[model samples]
Target chain A: MTQPRWLDQTEMAAWRAFLTTSHLLERRIEEQLKATAGLTHPQYEILVRLAAAPGRRLRMTELAEGVVASKSALTYQVGRLEEAGLVERTTCPDDDRGVLAVLTPAGAELLEKVAPGHLEIVREYLIDRLSREELRAMTSAMRKTEAALRSG
Target chain B: MTQPRWLDQTEMAAWRAFLTTSHLLERRIEEQLKATAGLTHPQYEILVRLAAAPGRRLRMTELAEGVVASKSALTYQVGRLEEAGLVERTTCPDDDRGVLAVLTPAGAELLEKVAPGHLEIVREYLIDRLSREELRAMTSAMRKTEAALRSG
Candidate 1:
């Protein structure tokens, strides 16, 4: 077999920084959400997505895709949210077998309360630390990365 | 409380791209590792870290930190690795209560075999897609983000 190509200095540096920052950012967000609102990161994402959707609801599959959660994982989180009266599942109007996740008023209120803290964490650790040009460059790079992964 | 500052368009774009790209990158890496090596991402991380450590061993707590896993989660992954004969646990020579995770020959061999395909995924999706300037910008931004999160 041919020899595998190894990462060069620049690639290695970028990859290591991305990996460390991603883990740290996720942990920081989870800590803030759990401490202030008693919600996990995935649960918080579900609420945010649902709150932004048209009519404040999304089909279950769409919600799963939006939150980058597997169907089973989404179901479990949705169940917990349902139990807490934060979200409710309803039969799709157009498709009997389809389900929709609808955010409740309680969920919206909680999101409004929790969102400021969430934004603070995001800004303090990520957005505010970078220059506008740096942010633009990183965003363009990640967008390309996302497109490639999706297509591949 | 005063109204919490919200993300502007530029910040929002960067945040969303980062979130989506991080998820996609992780999922792609996990899928590649699972298919080629029958290893989960965290398990692979453990082996890699162990292989790079002095004498191919690390204390459990140090291993956990290096891999960004919780102690219990690291314990569980290490248990599985040990069962597979790829890793072994031994008491620390200096500290009786301390446990060290040592990489077996099989573990290093597996990592060498799996690493090529893993690097391919990272390069194809992330590193190769960005320009040199973009890579530098992202690395700088992420390094700052990592520092802030680590301190905060």
Candidate 2:
């Protein structure tokens, strides 16, 4: 059998550190959002996307892609948000399978209220921790990685 | 009410890119490992940690902390691994509440067999996608962020 090719020392360190940091950062954001906003990170992302879209609404497929979640998972999350009166779902005018997620005024208000604490957490754990050059590098790396994955 | 402190354009762009890339990268890694090794990313992490530990074993608490998982989640995961004969658990001599997780030779062999495919996925989605400077910046940023979280 051929020997396995492992990540070299530098590559291994970078990969492991990235994994750990991503895990911790996500958990921190989730916990903070849960505590202060009664929303999980994924749920908050959905709200943010809806708020950013024109008329504060998006098709379900668009919403799933925007939040980087599976269609089924997004469906469930959106259903819960709708149940909570934070969002409403309407059938798309162009397609029957298409469902649009619209942010309720309550949802927008909740997001506005939660933004301060969420931003504070982000500033503390992520933005404030990196230098300007580092931030730019990170963003560039992420975009590169995303493009590679899409092509591959 | 106090004024909301939100992320500026640069920070927001970086943050969103990071979030999307991290989520997609993890999904790709998990898909690759599951297909090639029949292991979830969390399970693979557990196996690798056990393999690296002295005596190929660590207490459940230590394992959870090392894997960055909650205790209940670790217990559930370990139970599944145990049923698959990939790992075994024994009571710690010093503490009855403590259980040591030991990697089976089978598990070590599995990881050895799977490491190449896993590393390839990591390379495609992460390591190879970044320039040398970007890689260094990422590692440094992660280290700083992790340190800040730990200290906080």
Candidate 3:
């Protein structure tokens, strides 16, 4: 048997902190989004991603990739959004088989209304907690980790 | 309505990277743990938490808190673990009303087998992806964020 290589104190601390922070932050975000915006975190992410897209629309595949969600999950959320008149799935102008998710006027308005509370919560729990250098380092670390995850 | 406090470009970049990286990393970890250990990430977490506790036992509440899982979720996962003979929920020796999760011999054995693969995956996907200084900064950022989340 190959000997198991263990994480030393530094590595272990980093991993534990990352794991704990991520779990707590995600739960807190979900709770606030649910209570304040009547949306789950994934649903909010879908809205944000669509809102940022050109013409406030994205191909289904592109939105799924942008949100880092599974196709089926994105479809489910989009369906719920459609029911709420927040988004409409339309036939893709660029591809016969593809569909697009476009933010509806109501959805954009809702997003606008929800933005203040959501940003406040995010700022309180995350952005405001970090020093300027820490924020930059976090951004860099995330990018590096994401690149490695993608390549590996 | 209060004006939305928008994230400036730097804040936006940091938030987006954090959101994207966390989502992708979680899915990847769950997928790998499922494939390599026949365990969900939470299940693996439960095992590790139990194994680290003194006498490899912890009360249901403490286990839930330690794993940051909800009571109902922990109960469901514990039931599965019990069925697999990986863990045993026994009446606490010191408190008749308290239930404890104890790592079974089988669970310890399985953890030993799964440790190397899991560690390698963690290193490849996360720990090794960062420079030492980046890891330290990440640790600090996570700690600060987690403390903020807890207090607020």
Question: Which candidate has the top score in lDDT?
Answer: 1
- Full-model lDDT, candidate 2: 0.90
DockQ, all models? 0.88, 0.80, 0.80
- The TM-score of candidate 1 is 0.97
Ranking of predictions according to TM-score? 1, 2, 3
What tens-digit string does per-residue lDDT give for candidate 1 at A119-150? 99898899999999999999999999988877
Give all TM-scores, in the order shown.
0.97, 0.96, 0.96
The deviation in Å at residue B125 for candidate 1 is: 0.6
Q: lDDT of candidate 3 vs native?
A: 0.89
**lDDT per residue as tens, model 2, A80-146:** 9999999999999999988999999999999988888998989889999899999999999999898
Q: Candidate 3 on A10-106: residue-level lDDT in tens?
A: 9998988888788888898889899987999989988988898889999999899889989999889999999999999889877889998999999
For residue A18, model 2's alpha carbon misses the true position, in angstroms, by: 0.5
- lDDT by residue for model 2 over B56-126, one digit each (tens)? 99999999978889999999999999999999999999998889999999989998888888888888778
Q: Clashing residue pairs, candidate 1?
A: none
- Whole-model lDDT per candidate: 0.93, 0.90, 0.89
Q: Which residue runs does candidate 2 get wrong by more than 4 Å?
A: A1-4, B1-3
Error of 2 at B152 (Å): 3.4
Task: Specify the poorest-scoring 10-residue window by lDDT in model 3 chain B.
Answer: B1-10
